[model samples]
Target: MSRNGQRGQAAVPPAEFRSYYGRAVLKTPVWEWKIPAYLFTGGLSAGSAMLAAGADLTGRPDLRRTGRLAALGSLVVSTVLLIADLGRPERFHHMLRVAKPSSPMSVGTWILVAYGPGAGVGGLAELVPSGLRRALPGRLLGRMARPAGLAAAAVAPGVASYTAVLLSQTAVPAWHEAHPCLPFVFTGSAAASGGGLGMALTPVAQAGPARRLAVVGALLETAASRMLGRRTGASAEAYSTGRAGRLKSWAEALTAGGAAGTVLARRSRTAAVASGLALLAGSALQRFAVFEAGVASTKDPKYVVVPQRERVDAGIPVRGDDRAPAGGTG
Candidate 1:
């Protein structure tokens, strides 16, 4: 009814935003504390599963036992954490009741179910005495176990990558924008974690694959992170720049140090220890950086706007903008 309305003047500025520092703009995750706990447990399970597969293939029974135990323990912990995260833990069965390819969480649930049981059985087999095991086991038990371990190994890579997809599917700017690189980063971190565990437990002769895995994982992590930093604009600034920045930098340093030390793992016990410690430290730091970056991205509007605007200017759809709701959280 006013003159401004009649003249069709704008009601607000073309660009509007507010800072999110020290405040949450969206739902502050009321689900439960155990969600992140499950994430960590899942990562550990995936890492151990890989180690078990590698040991089986390499003819290291001792390493195989260690790896299988680690995998089983991680699965138990992960199950507990996941159930604790749900408000209706009773509905956990509903997870297996449905199949949805579009859902990363669903895919992860299936992977967990398959890997958990396989690892547990394999671990239990290792625990029983050979005579006792032979009494109940079929002639094909070893064959079945071998293939199951390999299946777990194949899924282990996805187990790491799927978590990234899970987070990126949400409204987190830093996470969604870095989806491509995040999977690779997480895969590398998982490999490093497994390698560290192997180095810590296996004898020098049996530690060959573990060392190579660590070196490859380190190189991959470093490259993926650098690419993420360069590609995502300010959305990924958290990865390289404050507390999160420092953590990411430290992760990189540790990864490099670990890779270098792995080369000398055969030389001496001290070198192996150093390498294992460095890789483990790097894994922890990388996880922390991932969470920190997600939180930081959610707290800043500039990160949401800048990248999308660039995309828009470049004639890209910008539909993947994290602020655009579920349709764009790709």
Candidate 2:
């Protein structure tokens, strides 16, 4: 016998890990492309709301106008994308029937509900017709605009980060593994997208906040994404392989290019627009890359089995275990 006499069927390595005839262990997310697009728009809206509030307070009328309008437009787009994904518009309103703080999806629904009005009023404040300037309704809108914008800004963080929670809570191993830094990744992407838009639309003289926001967003996104990619697990490999890897690589490159352009934006309007566009593109790609990674992880068996094996080797009990041991096992 060879060594320990391990032979025959036992020597064959257990007929490979076909848990269910090569089928995915977990059901992949049913979300379509619109879901990822919604992720981008939601972040864009949240970030733009905050930027508008900042611009309003800082006496930058052009920036404020641009931000307000952008927030409103993106919010509308996000709603449409989300509704489309649900396959019915009324399904969205149905989600409003109850509040569940413990549920990320539920919380996100509420956040969007709370976010819309403030953003709408804030943007509408900017679009008052010339003839209506002296009207009481216009005057009321003007008076309510600042408070409404600020409210939206206050809620924007939740708007930007909740999507991360929604993704992480799912069975997708890549996203679950990346939970710790996902919020930062998302919020940073949101900021980058919004700031990029600002840089594109606003002139250099009033674009200081946008420039700073872009830089900050880039920093947070790059750092957090690195953290995500560097995570110690088989699942993280999904982030650096196949189409997901390609998307992430492009995202990183574009984001870096955008960050670099921000440095020279003050000197050239062309640079500002170019940088802004790059950052916006990078943010969208980043979201799509993350979504793809999660979906990819669900397809790859290693993302499921390998992690469990690691836990078992470490004497950690899996889901059904009554008590997970603390010591390593042979």
Q: Which pairs, if any, clash in model 1?
A: none
TM-score quality measure for candidate 1: 0.83
Off by over 4 Å in 2: 1-18, 320-330
Q: Against the true structure, what is every candidate's RMSD?
A: 5.6, 5.7
The most accurate candidate by TM-score is 2
The most accurate candidate by lDDT is 2
Give one digit per residue, the lDDT tens place, for model 2 in 117-171: 9999999999999799789999999999999999999999999999888887766
For residue 205, model 1's alpha carbon misses the true position, in angstroms, by 1.8
Q: What is the alpha-carbon lDDT of model 2 when measured against the actual structure?
A: 0.88
